[model samples]
Target chain A: MDTLLSGQLLFAALVSGSLYALIALGLNLVYGTLRLLNIAHGDLVMIGAYTAFWLFTLLSIPPVVSFFVAAALCALLGWAVYEGMFRRLLANPGLAKRVEANSLILFYGISVILQNLTALAFTSSSRGYQYLDTVITWQGVSMTGNRLLSLGVAGGICIAALLFLRFHLFGWELRAVIQRREAAQIVGVNLNRVQPIIICAGFAIAGIAGVLVSMTEQITPFMGFPFTIIAFVVIIIGGLGNIGAGVLAGLSLGLIETYGVALTSPGYRSILIYGLFVAVLLIRPEGIFTKAVRS
Target chain B: MKALDIIFGLALAIGGLLVPLSGDAYLMGLVFQLAMWIALAQSWSMLSSTTGYLSLGHAVFYGIGAYVCVLLTGVVPFGVALAAGAAASAVFAGLIGLPVLRVQGPYFVILTYGLAELVRNVVMRIESALGSFGRMIFMVPSFEVLVWCMVALGILATLGAAAVRHSALGAGLAAIRENEVAAETVGVPVARLKLLAFVASATIPGAVGGLALLRTGYFEPAQAFDPVISFTIVTMALVGGTETVRGPVLGALGFTLLSEALWSSLPQLYMIVLGLTLIAFILFVPRGLSGLADRALGRG
Candidate 1:
């Protein structure tokens, strides 16, 4: 038990929590604003990771630069998805709800397409990068500099996101649309313009998170499944559509999972996470926080 | 009309029986597997379509039945094990459905999907439960016996769907599907009806899963609890037509044959094909094959 309280484990859990928070935040943003459960969100994360991997491996780009490039590419992809798929669905009055279900199938198909494409291009082997060589060791505890850097970056992103939503005009319009789509439309708020931006921003966040996660973990085409599941659980726990709650839930999950792994086998950690989800769902289906989004 | 329907049904049944006897072993196996899939699709439709609760985790029940049957056969005869597996799956369905069924729409779908993953992870981690090897298969029976078992299951599944579609419980389920609060206010026991549908839905899949496990003489966690199976079953139900007695069976037959053909020709692109097909069905034929048939036949 003493070994569990070591600074290394604590730092590791915090770092993992930061990354999980990033993933959860991406999911919450889309779910909150769009009311669309994008099952392809995880695939976006995978795409981001793959993009970064290719930039670093093929183009000889630095990790940090690759991360931004990956995020930008994902944002573009998100825009295309909205313009091509979701926009058409939203245009139809009767097909709105059906669109959500249909999108699951569509996105899942896209996911398969992307995964197979990656497999065809790169083969089904794991990949990694070793750009950051800094390591900090103190009092018999060691931690990687890259992890600390990712955590700091994630924190910065979260703060920036919150501020953007709080102060920016476009963010305000986005919120307005989410809160009352018809009212926003009545006010001449161009939903057609705003929705694509929101979707792009959401995908960008997920892509960045993907890049960050890949730094700490191995990159594989199938890595999105666990991320998707974890993010979904986090969003559900934090109260769907609430960004702050997602962060809290993600952090809590990270800590819980870290300690859970330390105490039990890694296999049992998932069960515990799911048990927490079921427990929360049974007790408070609305999640730990139910504050309405400012939108 | 009733006489014609009966005659057609008998002819179809006889055709299915003759396939195994006259067809090659591989072809017969494929036909049998198709029948099993049809049974699974029908069971899924009974719950998802009629109840409007799209469960993305139904493989949990199927896997449970398969695992239970495999385990129980050591202590009991094959027939008893099969029944036990079905009963056990029903019990599991009823239990899991309790908390989940409370949620509406997408929440229910997500929760069910998560629950299925949880079950899969639990099974994977608990080596003792599924054995260290992850799956265990029982000894296979003779081809004739296996054929009879599958035929009996197909008939039972069809009858079950027909019964559910016409029963008082079916009416209540339909009401709940239409509007839960309204159904509740109108004296329909919403929870009870859902639980009944869920449990009843489990019976055919459980039995068929057990039979499938016996037929293949092997089982694996990945094979038994694949999300693809759930997707395939739901797709068949939706593509064939949901909330109709014959829709799922028709869906199963069509989907399985399509899948086999695709797999044989373009194995790598089979899933992609399925995905595109699903997308087309969702976009163009939301009501599935039955709707298409109705349109083509000039029937309202």
Candidate 2:
């Protein structure tokens, strides 16, 4: 444990964790506020990666610049998804039971559609961009420039999101809805408007994660599903709707994954990660949080 | 109702008989695929529809069954291998259900999903475990034979579904689904009933997975433990209608035919179309075909 706790592993773990946090934050945000699972959340990430990839390849735009553009596009997509799919299911208060059963299928279908569309455009080929192609070493530990860039951006996004939720007026409205929906509305929060904003905001956050991914690792049309699964693991471990705990959980999970792969072969990595995920559920299904903090 | 039942049985038997006599490989292949999906849909319906617990990890049992059959090929008779596969799947379900089943709502859904992924990753580590993408041994069975076997298995599964629909156990599951706390308060023995349903639901998928892999002459991890298969199976059951015997069977048949038609014509865009269809179906027609049929019959 002592030897593995060196700068390199810690840096790697922190980077991976921030990326995971970026993904999980969007997931839990949507879940907490909209009461929808958004199975297509990872597809937002995939689309963001593809968008940045295209911008970089065609317009010579760097991923750093394209990240904002992708995030904005994803926010629009989220708005379309809500207006087209989620609004009606939620409009009726009496349909809550039925909604639970159908929303899963709905989001699943959305994911499949997005994945197919992505494949059609990109031909299912894996792509990556070389941004900040430099390596820096500190005390015999080396870090890729691109990875370090992702790490910095990821941490910035997480902190910014945290602050936005903690102090922003819109964030307060979202929290109110998440904690007590009917009461929040009665207290004069226009749910009709606020809900869509949260949903869009969540998508934008996921888009940022996707662009970050393009800088750090490989991107494929099918990559969205695995990341979605990983995001779910992080949120569950961190506690549903609790961003702080989720970020912490992502960091710990990242550490576990890094050290586990180091100890065993790379193939056993997912096994180790999922084993811990399941163990967490068995031990504390609500996660490590004392209270359910949706924001 | 009895007449409909008899006609359905007669049609199935006649269809099964004609396939062997005609010996058309294409027809045989299509029927085999349809039967495999039907069996899987039926297996998934046993719990998901009745208990309202959407298990996103049902493919683990299917993959396990496939692997088990492949391993026991020379060591045991085909009958023993099939039985062993079913038993193994049920046992695995029992063990997992003890913990995950305690969770409710989305947590239950994702935990089961996680379990399937864990199994898939572990399976990926085994040497030669994922046969060349679906190729089973040559000595397994012909397409016609496999089709007939699947038909027989599917029928048995249907009978099981019918029994569960009318049984006291089914009522208990329904109660649990409606309100777990209330059911428990009313002495419904929620955990035991759920475990039983989970085991029962898992067995046929496991057995049929072995049959599927054996017939296909392969067992790739991606194909065997594919999460999409679970989603598709659930969609079929839902589209046909849940909490009924015929809905899943009809759903399987309808989806198989619809999928084939779409794939043959569109090929490239079929998945997107299917996804759209599923979304539309869930949104506009949540009750599915069986529910439509029930309404036409004016049972309500």
| Predicted model with the maximum TM-score | 2
Candidate 2: C-alpha lDDT: 0.81
Model 2 TM-score? Answer: 0.94
All models: lDDT? 0.77, 0.81
True-contact fraction in model 1 equals: 0.33
Expressed as tens digits, the lDDT of each residue in A63-146 for candidate 1 is 688678878988998888788767776776656755545566666666666666666567779998876757888888787878
* Best-matching candidate per lDDT: 2
Give Cα distance to truth, residue B266, candidate 2, Å: 4.9
- Least accurate stretch of 10 residues (summed lDDT) in model 2 chain A? A92-101
